[model samples]
Target: MTDIIETYLEDFGPALSGTISEHLEKSLGISAAAARKRVSRASGNIRRLGYVTFARKARFMYLENQFGSPLYWRKLVDALFSTNSAYGYAIAALIQREGFVPEWEFPIVCGAPIKQSRHLSPATIMQRLKEAGLLQTIQVNGLGDCICIVQSEEHYNSLAADTRVRLITENILLLAVKDWLRKLGIVSFDKVTIRSSTHAPKVGTFVWDLTAPSYLGCLIKTGKDKKVKPGFVAADVYLGDTITEPGSRPFINKCKTLRALRNVGPCMQIFIANRYEKEAFSLLKQNGIMPATPESLFGEDVAKGLSELTSVLHDAASHSLDPERFERLFAALGKIEGAANQLRGTLFEYIAAEVARKNYSSLVRMNQIYKNQSGKKAEADVVIITDNISVRFIECKGYSPRGIIPDTEVRRWLQHNVPVIYKAVKVHPDWQNLDIKFEFWTTGILSDEAIAMIKTAQVSTKATRYSLGFKLNQDVYDLCKSTKDKGLITAFEKHYLPPY
Candidate 1:
């Protein structure tokens, strides 16, 4: 650890505004700007600060603090980490032990930004420390961010005043996992992957929300744009250096509006969620958040867009379709609308993702596009139009083309039209191996009968056109594998049964 950072940590306590920079420069005689820039990463949570960039920006990033009281993160964070390889761990630990209190603090350190390399990684080092049993989780307020402080005595005997120096450095290797490794042109089938940096990080990409008082998230994507702006989409992403072991979903369910924008089609591309596009754009411009040019923000009119989508589906009632087909789309739209209303704030993304994951297409005033080179406008329950000759959708329970469309539904429906809209569409003989034909997907996750129906479908024009099946990609795990919260798991297992 640098002597400057060590001394600075001694003098520093919880932070707020320019107090951090001002105090550091005054005491250390360094440039004030450098101090502010350094300290923000070393101590602040970008989600709470609204300015410090950590990772992708989204409605969650923008609105995470709106509904809940800020966590008194010091206790929880303190309990979860121990000063080991960190630059100022010993000094900071001493100051914390002294119970130093800075008056009128705004929890800046809890929500600080980052601009450091591996040896200086604040977040990564902490997670690794926790995993190595150097940290412990304690519920301080009985149930809040004010959880317990470090279990100092737990490992006191395990350490010495002078432990092996090389061994200490070995503990810091996990910090490297926190660094974003840039890979250019990882995929050549389409556009290149992009990544945003700690400053002005992009939103709606994969993010890591640290459920603590110093709550911040690590926004990750494929491209090399290092700013946190909203309205972006990508898939096949996991969190960075999580406390959980490797291969877990490193993302939280962004809100409904953003959820509406993600297209988990067969290709699994295009993940968007930042309030609404227009609002996000203006906010980004106003906040000096630079996205990779042509950024789309979330619209403020999500509700209206949803209503219009339903009306279009309602219009389908009179189009060239069978009574059963009409019934399916109509019912599906109603459920989505109902689900949208029932979950106005939280889990909108979860519901939407579940719906999309179960089926690729929907019947709502869905943004239609050519599903393949065959020029067929794909439909949905969960619809996926892929570059490889295939197009598909799911049919959920009680949803059909002839169901009721609700009124006054708020929230903008995402424009989920496949990229090659109105272009040559290809169809595959089989969905996993479609040889070029329209693929109709309907509900299958709910019943064995539904899946069975798909296996015995007729392919001629005289057929029902839509099929039923329960097919999931290899990446989809039981969501259970992703979380390790004992209390949450216990509660879920105690009551709800897992879906087979």
Candidate 2:
């Protein structure tokens, strides 16, 4: 009976109407009217047995038995609901090729685009899944517009724990890199771009995660002819609290990733978040991997110089009208010996702050770190508090050669950082009532798509409370050009201001 039903369905495809009866009659050597009765009986039996479903109104057959389990159905739903047909097929193929596990661990599987025909947004995909009894979505605050999908309530709790650990560990890795760069006199928060493969464009890019043969680091170097030469660096960032066992599956996967990265380049470093992960360190060392803590990245003199430089900047922020202190700080930064690019980033932040202080009524604070009630912290590059109690939270990005900021970076700031700022404002007693605004101040050209996304995000419920502004390359140049200080203007033009 199952074979006959399967054969009939296979001949006519998932949806059957007159074609099923016509094919059955020809194949079974039966009269057309008799074959029609058999078709009805077979469909009824299949539906009663709960192996397949027949939609009466739609007159379509759906093979529910093809999906072995709810997990399998979930995978099919993910593929069917992808952004476009091609992208959907690609995701489905990837799942098939990679063998979907309960804990898939791929970033693309969670946040990839949904089919346009369904008119579903990423935020609403889980609701549709829940209606189908495939998955449930759980809202998690402070995680910034995230969705958690699970097969069951018990699975949701287990996955949520894993997700939180992953997020915290990733955040630690980002903060650690920023701290290391700051200690080395690199101050621009946008110098390093952290992106997952799921967010990358579809063409010529492979999915990358903590356990992938991804382009972990690509540092651009100026050749002898002054042309740009890109160099790849292999680095593994691991937080001890997240991955405790040196012999665990995750650790093994990371080792495999590192091996693949090493095949492409010889220069590699292992960055451990906790110094007490001695077993992990030993494992790396045994495998000939060089491990370094953030503190050990710089010399004592360089560390001391950075400390003094921080003090000078703080003094300038506090005493913006003090020309002598400003000059001294600028001169010290110029004289400090290090990577030119790193110094350029540091100079960009300071000049941005200086420009803001000169133009605004007063600098309430610059480079201040704020934490929300949920304990999510964000550092604002510059904050201007007007006489009317209006506050501006500015984000500065220094991308040299212009027009290099990708759409992913713009989306990251909007979807993630904007919420952080919103929450920070909500929790602060003094700033809660003030008219707040956000400005993306960059020395790089903004793409039209990025600008549009920003405009849309500004009015979105996630950021509707604050007004949005943009300060692009041209704006920065104009702001710097207005200053009468020739030396300061020249320095700004050379480092922070982009050419026309």
Candidate 3:
């Protein structure tokens, strides 16, 4: 199931929806788009079908059909054809210039690299070619032998003249290389590597991510052999015989974040962990600013930084004889730091994650329970358990005055000591308040007092300043109390409640 979903994601990033997508699965063996794409394709009205409805809810859209109807399929096919007018234009240009369409597979067989424009896919282009009936497949004995399906066509007719194909060919090659170059964030080809490959169009491109505005890659393998490696000769002055051939690339202008913060105020940082994450953190540290999530990306430092900053701000405002002075200073500092954040975009993630976590359900809502284990020691902040048909975890947050989840607690959970990270981030009034949620999940039981306790707990101003955990307002407390007292679970389908 996961594989099918991932396959869909790989094929279509966004423009996926509705029932015609289903037609593709049934007719083309491609599952996972909405049934409506076929409709959108046909009528240009995209919402005709999809799991966005109740029938397909159980199946993730990416794993579902494109659309549920056939009329929609025709629409989609027509849309694809109408959209490729540019391809036709280019082909027509080439044909006119050369005075011929060049035996259907002539260009490909004679050796030409094929890649789609940035907004399109090679597969989509191939599909268009199939629709135009202009493609002629052949059995090539070498590297680029995709799938052997020999072609036989008596006569071919194209809407445009001969010049389209030639012009399109040139454009395709240039665009493929340009897109590849963008991946490496480079603008100049002078400092590039181009090598031949055993494949039909043998050429690969590379560049630095930081050095270039965008990272694009392309390899045009044109022929078969031991003489080629789909390799390229780059003008990386420091480049050795190979791209990754240590010392072949630039010194990766990696400056630490801490170091970059030299001129800035205190700040927080989280290291997402992989090599890239570490490199990012290193860059921040190098800049001389506070990198919050240390130890691990979400380590003690995050909580500490928040706590420290909160305290510093609140303390200064509270203790100073002239509070106005501190307020003015703080406001000025906030502007300066906000500007830095605008430039970096890292600090916003913490706040964004909090917002997203609340609005996002699914795997994210599972944050309600986190799991961990302990062999010989007790864990702090959480607990875990499992049974025949269910698994449950409890997280206890110690949101005292400076209210924030400690990194030690995160480490504890990673060590199987704590149950989850969110619970630890919340500043609930009573520990027992949440204990009942765990009981409800595991035993299918809920205690009125426990329900009331959690529901009644109010959000602390301190905790709100940090993590965006739900505030357990009065309405929730009452709702839980009423639900528990009425034994709504027992009522099941017959249950009904007043619109409080």
Candidate 4:
């Protein structure tokens, strides 16, 4: 019984009294009263179950050893995330890592489009987190309202101020680089994998302060005349005032890793810091890494703005507010927020692209926009042209592995996007002779009604000019692993795989 309860707590994270009884009754096929009694016994036995009481009424159940360790909060938050939706985990991870997030920007950071709502609204996510005792909404001195982790004052301040500043500075640098890439019009994959400081840096790995994979040329162009090359641009940011030779060991080692990966493609590696010693800069330059300052990468004005903004935001998170400084920082706020939002909400599209790139050596495009005669436009998340004889249009949905894709979305895809793209392709001079295959791909399940809608469309279109199909989480995983690319597999596991 103890082992069973321990396993349950480990898998589900800390649970309240009522939730514990509910799970026990279901798992053991026992009465509610019996389950409650068992919980009472185990919770009392300090040798087995560790329980914490909040407000003298709400009890949280967990393994005894994890209650107050340094990793306690991270583990608990992660466990809770595992049981929730993908968006839930994404939002939680972002907030917990940052330690403080502004209330207004929370939605945007969670991939919500400007002036539009995602499948899960920001308010709903916040409420859920509050109910789980993971976060709270509070007013900062000048930031209005901010969302922060729920912990004692001591635990919250235990993280060194320098470490906190470093985390925030790195995040700022990543956003600045992303904005720079977007301005250059070469951001192939909108989603970026930002580094987290929760663990020691791994050598010989692709993880960096910022990673954005982009194409060098136009993606919309077709036929034999068009040339598009794919590569990844990665950067590492140092927060210290200046990097001396001895202090540059970590960055130098990371540059070595990036050099080793150059054979993978034409990747651009950047080392960003406030300043670098002459010898250190020379070493980085000799390593084929672009050693730059925030001012050099982004103009001096923008760099100064970012530096001030980072300082102000860190101060705000630490309960020090400067309304005047915070207000002045808004000059560059729009671009930064847009860049961060762009870096999210498209994980699945990139995943689908990987599957196609591995399966076909022909022309593959992402975020392709097509127009009809009347100038109406539609965008396909991913497009692949194989042998110049078959064209595949893939629509990707980045939903939670445990969530369901809505029937309305499915209906719209089948009724609107498919027919429009099919007509557009059939009339295009470049694709006149190619067969069409339209596939709906998602990292989630489809309800029975939604499946029926898709199946009906599939059969009705069977004899038509284009074929229709779909790929769920398991289907995607099977195809991703089939590619035998370790990077692709790791991405699938991180973004698409079910926690269980």
Root-mean-square deviation per candidate: 23.3, 17.6, 27.7, 23.5
TM-score, model 1 to reference: 0.20
Q: Who wins the TM-score comparison?
A: 2
Off by over 4 Å in 4: 1-344, 462-464
Alpha-carbon error at 46 in model 1, in Å? Answer: 29
**Which regions of candidate 2 deviate over 4 angstroms?**
1-338, 401-403, 459-464, 498-500
TM-score ranking of the models: 2, 4, 1, 3
2 against 3, candidate with superior lDDT: 2
> lDDT of each structure?
0.27, 0.48, 0.27, 0.61
lDDT of 4 by residue, 1-500 (tens): 66667777677665655577788999889998898787767743223222222332434566766554435555444433444333334334344334554454454333221222223445665676677565677544223245666655444434434444554556767777777777776665565556642222221243455666666642222335565445667676765557654334444544553455423445667778888889878987887778888889778776887677567645544334443454455455435744322222344566677678777644676666665766555668888888767899998887767767888888988887888888789898888888899999988789989888888887877554888999888998999889887666775676567897
In every candidate, how many clashes are there? 92, 3, 116, 0
Model 3 Cα shift for residue 29 (angstroms): 32
Model 1, residue 268: C-alpha shift (Å): 22
lDDT of 3 by residue, 1-500 (tens): 33433354335532333333564567556545543433233322122222121233321232223432232233332332244322332232223222122223222321112332242223343455445433333322111112111133211222121222222222222223334454444434444322112122212211211121212234223344523212222211110011121111011111121113233222121111112234534543564423332123223433233233333333322221222432333333323222222211111112122222233211221112221232132222112222222222333331211223344533343333222333442333333223222211111122355444334432322332222222222222233344442322222111112224
- Candidate 1 residue-wise lDDT, 186-214, digit = tens: 22222223222111222332222111011
